[model samples]
Target chain A: MTAAEERAVIDRVRRGETEAFEALVLDNQKKVYNLALKMTGNENDALDISQEVFIKAYTGLHNFRAESRFSVWLYRMTYNICVDFIRKKQRTPVSSLTYTDDDGEYMDLEIPDTRYEPAVEAEKRELREALSRGIDELPQHHREIIVMREMTGMSYEEIATTLGISEGTVKSRLSRARQNLVSLLNSYGTFSKSGRHKTGKEVEGHG
Target chain B: MADCKKYMDMISCYADGELPEQEQKLLLAHLDGCASCRALLSAYRSIAEAAEETLVQVPDGFAAGVMEKIRKLPRRRSGGWKAVRPVIISFAAAAACLALVFTVSPQRFDFGRNKAKMSARVEAPDMADTAERGTDSVLMDSAVPEAGSGEFGGTEAAKSDEESLFLYEAAGASADVETPQTGMATATDSPAPNGAATDGQPVDSTSQVTRHPGVKLGIAGVDENTLVIYYAVFTFEGALPDHVTGVEKTDRGGGLYSLVVTADVARELINEGYTNYVIGNEDAETALVYYTED
Candidate 1:
């Protein structure tokens, strides 16, 4: 929906029209859930966080202020809720940890469809798993910035505003995060040196 | 050629298309002559591509699940007596007592010392230890009425104390304060500096005294409207709390510390064994609790 339509929906939700919130939930849930998935690396935890974010947004609808885009505000809430969830998970003992049933619901979009040949599918799965592992290894702040920039595609301005940091800090931090990811992928032997060279040539030719 | 190291750092920004026109042009020119830089740029691009291509799909009915949960949440009531219940109760109780006293003895209502004693009788339990600690003396210095300023009946003294108490209650009710700036008091032994008051009011040390079981404590001079209280428990001496919830701390120069927490978190921290002192009324803009342990 356009920004104006989203604002109208929000206005209705704030005016005691509870069902109007569903439009917002539908519009933003994918990005919000994906962000949680990327940040937490656990599908159940992502779902839990995503649900919690929408619930919080519904309750906090009156505080929306409409100063920034609704999506930016919602993303900020998602980021903070994920951070808190991570902190809570760290505090909880492993014995008390519980996992939700897989239920075949959460899917990794990067996984190739059945149409792909088995060998290509396996390689794609390996590459995707390696990238996930690489992302998981990053420190929380770096992971957050990477997800915000890379996964969510937020501009530096939106990220800086969400994180309450300078755009300069965002740039430097994002650079550091990417470098760390590259080093990790390299260490895992996911990308060969020659492969990188070939990729460079292809990109340069395109440029 | 542009220095490889300098341009290498800019490659990520260039890859993201964040660099200014001149810097992008410079980096592009450098890349043409530099093989290693080109490889680095390519690696950065690859990483970016990999990151972008990485997408996680939500479970089916994800939005529906969220909507279901939201529907289960109890609906919040619109403003009414329910919204202002606490304020009404406090004001009604205070007024009722005043009315009872006036009906019993009209002459007694005009006595400043009697009024002071009555207010003290109502306020003393909360401030008793603070008075004994001499913090009240420091606080009174800032707020005590001049000799001829109608000490008990003076609007200034009454208003300031009432406002101070009101700010405190308001803070306790709402735990929403801006992040407080750390002040420069580092030594545990040194007195809090002059500007440490959260609201820029002279810290009324007497107004915020809390008597814990064995310790007589004061929040020194925090303004509730601008600061929230954080409950910090250091496992060892000088260690920070392991899990801080909504609140964040500001180092007030010495061993003294100030915390800012949301009103909800502040309420949770209260009675959780942290030294609790409040400053601000119901109308106060922020809820701030200044906590420290002896």
Candidate 2:
């Protein structure tokens, strides 16, 4: 629904036409579910997050600012809930910065050969699966930025606002996330011409 | 090649069409010479394409279920928690003596599994105070609109004074929490050791766990995973702020548990970016505080 439509239904619900809230739920559930699903990587947890988000938005409707788009506000809520759930589930630090540990070994960024890249659109299904697995392998912060931008199509500004970070941080983190995914898929070597036992660059040649 | 790092960062923005006009020109010019960055951009686009197709079907009747729960919400008059909290605090202070009586007996109450059924009283003097608090709580409860016809206000209408006082905040967590009154604790698996239930142990057993529904609903808007924090001193930094009125060190070597405070204190912890602490075991008037050092 448009922000206006959302506002209208919200007014109706506030006016005691409680059923009108369902329209808001239906309008936002799919993307919200997709965002949640990608973040948690669990169907049940995703559903739990999505359902809870709407229930919260309805109950806390009064706190929503008039100038804000409900979708942005909704996605922000989704990100926060998933982050808390993630923090609770895995009691590890969800940091995005590059750091060296006590052992003096680099722990954050690892460089993979960009030359051995998968050919895009050559084998869509297999490439898709490779990407999915690659996403799962990413660090928690990387997974969040990737899902927010590439998967859920949130703009950098939106992601920055949603995550309470600067837009520059959003861009940098997203860059790292994509690089890590490419590195992962490169190791998979699904359509990499240089990969052993693969000669052709597949049908979709590199530009 | 050294400049490629800067251009590489721009490629992500470029793919999303978020790159500025000048930076876009610079990136495009750089891309002509940098095959690696070009490959990276292609990979980013391909990832987006695949993600666009990757979706989990919304479980059937999702909307209907949400509405079914929403329709059951209690009607609100001129207020919500904001309207009711102050009254509860003033009265809960009058009942403040119960805070001692409440904390002293831990196993007597089970905050989870709906196992809190402590009927035994301290004595007649405290009983008079307890009875007074109970009446004040009922008066506090009257500020909220009466619950809708359903499973609520059923067997709960006759719960003992302690149960009623403690359960009031759970009931206040959200509207949905009020209805499924019977099985609110249906999801909890680990019972958090009722033996030393009153001792605040800072444990982080993050294995897949569930909590009573009201606690979940209560922190849904702010922070959902808060109640999992086991203690204060281990996870919270610095000395307890002066606002932390009572700081009785436990026998567990400087460990502290069971903070009773007002609402703004809870908001302060949340706003200060302290993820480890959260409010719990609250009535309309007072709250149980858990702040973490980590």
Q: Judging by DockQ against the true structure, name the best candidate.
A: 2
lDDT of 1: 0.48
Tell me the lDDT of candidate 2. Answer: 0.50
State each model's CA lDDT, in order: 0.48, 0.50
Best by TM-score: 2
What lDDT does candidate 1 reach at residue A193? Answer: 42
Per-residue alpha-carbon lDDT of candidate 1 for residues B1-294, written as tens digits (9 for 90 to 100): 224545644887988888999888888888788665676666666566666566766778887877776665433345211122121111211222223323334352333323453344333332333223322121111222122232221224433342332332233344343223322232234333334433332222222222110001112222232211222111112322333332345434334344544444433322121211322232222233333334
Residue A205 of candidate 1: its Cα lDDT?
9
Among the numbered candidates, top lDDT falls to 2
Candidate 2's TM-score:
0.55
Tens-digit per-residue lDDT, A1-207, candidate 2: 776777787778766667788888888888888888878878888888787777666655654556556776778778866765776587343333332221122122223334534445557778778877777767667777887787667777778766656787787777766765665676677435322211111121010
After TM-score superposition, the amount by which residue A147's alpha carbon in candidate 1 deviates from its true location, in angstroms, is: 0.8
Please report the interface RMSD of model 1 to 1 decimal. Answer: 10.9
Q: Residue by residue across A37-142, what tens digits does model 1's lDDT show?
A: 8777788888887886776567545545565778877788787666645664762221221111111111111111222221465665666777777777666666
Worst 10 residues of 2 chain B by lDDT: B178-187
